[model samples]
Target: MENIGVRAKELNETIVTLRRELHAHPELEHDLPFTESVVVRELAKLGLDELKPGLGQGHGVIATLRGKKPGKVLALRADMDALPIREETGLSFASTNGNMHACGHDAHIAMLLVAAKLLADAREELAGTVRFIFQPSEETVDGALSMIASGALENPAVDEIVGLHTGNLWEGLTPGQIGWKAGPMMASTSTLTIVFEGKGGHGATPHLTVDPIVIAAETISQLQTLVAREVSPFEPAVVTIGKISGGSAHNVIAGTCELRGMIRAFNQETDAFLKRRIRATAEGVAASMRGRATVMFSGDLAAVVNDKACALKMRDIAANALGEEWVKELALPSSGAEDFAYYLAKAPGAFFYHCSTFESSEGGAECNYPHHNSKFDVNESVLWTGAAAMAAYALHWQDRN
Candidate 1:
C-alpha cells in the first residue's frame, strides 16, 4: 500500500472544516441528533457497503466498508459526546450552545470520518471490512453497551476492534506522535450516591436532635483514607466527593443529607476494594451517630486493558504510516476512565492516544488545558496523523493474520 500519511495530509482541510462544524454545535451524551446526522451525511457520500442508523437507542451511526473479499472485520470507533460546560476557547468556531467539546470528541469524529473516506476510496483492493462506529454517551458510560445490545457486534460479527482518543491526556508526546500501551490503558469509573437519614429537630435543642449532617461529614472524612491507608502506595486510586446536599434552614436540622461522588482505579480488584471500604465506612459512621445510611452505586465502567498482539500490530502500522519516531510507548496508565472498555470486553482491541497538545511556545499553557476543563482545546496541525494511522491500521491488520 502507498503511504497513507500523504493521503491524510491531502484531506487535512476537509477534516478541519468538519471538526469545526461539530465543535460549534456541541451536544451531550446519547441524544446526539445533530452529531449523528453530520456523521451519517459524510459517511453516506462515501458509497460504503452498509450504513446503519439509530442504534444505541438514540443516534449512533455505523458505516461499514466491505473489501473485495470477505475476511476479518475491524471496527474503528470514535465517541461523539461533549461535556456540559460552557466554551472558553474563544475561537471563531467554538461552541456557544452552553455545551462544550472540552475533551476533543469533535476532533475524534472528524478524523474517523475522513479515515472512512480513505478506506472507501481503496475498498476494491482491501482484503477485509472496516466498521466505523460513531458512538454517543461516552461521558455517561452507556453508549458502548447500548450499541452492543442493539446488535452492533452481530451481522458481520466484528473479529477485532480499535479506537483512538485525541488530546493532551498523556504527556511526554509531541503533536502528531502516537502513544500506545500494552495493558491497562485507562481506569474504571464507579459513581457513588449516599444518603444519611436521622431525626430532625429545632437547632436550639442540639442534644435532642440527631444530626445527619455530622454523620455525613464523618463518612466523607473516612472515605478519604480508604486509598491512603488500605491500598498499597504503588497502586493509584481516587475518591472525589463532587456534590453534597442537605439542610435548608439554619434554625432546623434536616432529616436527611445526601452525598454524591466518583471512584476511579486502574483495575477491577482495586476498584472493588475501594467500593467495599466506602460502603462499610459510610454505614458504620451513620450507625455510630444514630443515623441510618443508604449507599448506592449508580454506574461503573471497567478499566481498558489493551490486547497485546493487537497493540503491537497497530504500533508498528502507525510507525509505518507515520514515522517510527512518531510512535512511542506510554510509560504509565491513565487514572481516567473510558466506556470503550465495554467494547474490549466483547472482543480484543487496543486504544491509541493521538497527541493534539500544544507546547507553551506554540499556543501558551492556557490552550493546552486538561481534558473536561472549560478551556480545553486541541492542536489542529496533527489531526491527519491520527486519521492516517487508523486508516493504515485497517489496511494492514490482515498481514499479520
Candidate 2:
C-alpha cells in the first residue's frame, strides 16, 4: 500500500477547512440536521457505491463502498455531536451557536470524512466492502445502540470494526501520536439517582423534622465505603456525586433530597458489585435514620473491550502508515466512558486515541484543556494523522482478514 500519511498530508488543507467549518457551527445530540447535511454533501462528492441517509432517527448516514475483489467486510465509525457548552476557546472559528465541540467530535467528523475520500479514491485496490458509519447523540451514550438497532451493523455483516477518538487524555503522547490498548480501553458508566425522603419542618425546630439534609450528608459519607472497603483495591471503581439538590430556603428543611451521580467500573463483576452495594448502602443508611432512600440506575454504557488481535494489527498498521515513533501502547484504561463499547460488543474491533495537543504558535500556553471543558481544542495539524490511520487500517484490514 502507498504511504497513507503522505496521501493524507496532501489533503491537510481540506481536512482542516472542514474541521473549522464544523467547529464554527456545532450541533448537539440526535438533532444534527445541519451537521448531517454537511456530511452528506461532502460524502456525495466521493461517488460511493451506495448512500443511505436518515439512519438512527434521521441523524446517521451510512455509505458503502464495494471493492473490485471479494473479501471480508469492515466498518469504520465516527461520531457527530457536540456538547451543550458555550465556547470559550477564543479561536477565529469558535462556535457561536451556544454549543461547543468540547469533546473533539468536530475533529472526528472531519478526519472520518477525509478518510472516506481517501478510501473512495482507492476503492479499486480495496477488497470486500467498507461501511462508513456517521453516528449521532454519542454524548448521551445511546448513538451506537441506536445505529445498531437501525441495522447499521447488518447488511454486509461487518467482519471487524475500527474507530478513533481525538483528545488530550493520553497525556504521555504528544501531538499526532496514536495510543491504543489490547483489552479493556474504557470503563462501564451508569448514572445513579438516590432520593432521600423525610419530613419537612422549620430549621429552628429541628427536633420535629426528620431532616433529610442530615441524612443525605450521612449517606454521602457512608457511600465512600463501597469503594474503599467493598470493592477490591486491584480493580478501579469510581462513585462520584456530581449534583445534590433538596432545600429551597434556609429556614425550612426540605422533605426530600436528591443526589445524582455516576458510577464507573472496568469489569462486569465490579460494576455489578458497585451497583448492588450502592443501593444497599443508601437504603441501609437512610433506614438507620428516620428517612427512606430510593436508588435508580439509568443511561448505562458497557466497557469498551478491544479485541487483542485487532489491536495488535492496528498497532502494526498505524506504525507503517504513521511511523513507529507515532504509535504507542497505552498502559492503563481510561475511566471515561464511551457508547462505542456497544459497537465493540456487537463485533470484534479496536478503538484508538489520537493525541491533539500542541504548543501554541503564538507563544501562549498550549491548548491542553480536557474533553468536556469549555475551552477544549485540538491541534489541527494532526487531524490528517487520524484520517491516515483510519484509511490505512481499512485498506490493510481487508487484506489481512
Residues 1-401, candidate 1, lDDT per residue (tens digit)? 47788999999899999999999999998889999999999999999989999999789988889999667999999999999999888899988899999999999999999999989887877778888898999888899998899877777899899999999989899898999999889988998999999989999997898999999999999999998899999998899999999999999998999999999898889998988889999999999999999999878889999999999998999998888999999999898889999999999999989999987789677678999998888888889999998999999988888
Per-residue CA lDDT of model 2 for 1-401, tens digit only, reads: 47789999888889999999999989989999888998999999999988888999778999999877788889999999999999999999999989999999999999999999999888888888899999999999889988998899899898899999998877688788889899989999999999999999999998899988888899899888888988889989999999999999999999999999999999888888889989998899889988999999998889999999999989989999989998999999899998999998889999999988876663435568878999988889888999999999888875465
Instruction: Looking at model 1, report the run of 10 residues with the lowest lDDT sum.
Output: 359-368
TM-score of each: 0.95, 0.96
Q: Please give the distance, in angstroms, between residue 391's alpha carbon in candidate 2 and its true position after superposition.
A: 0.8
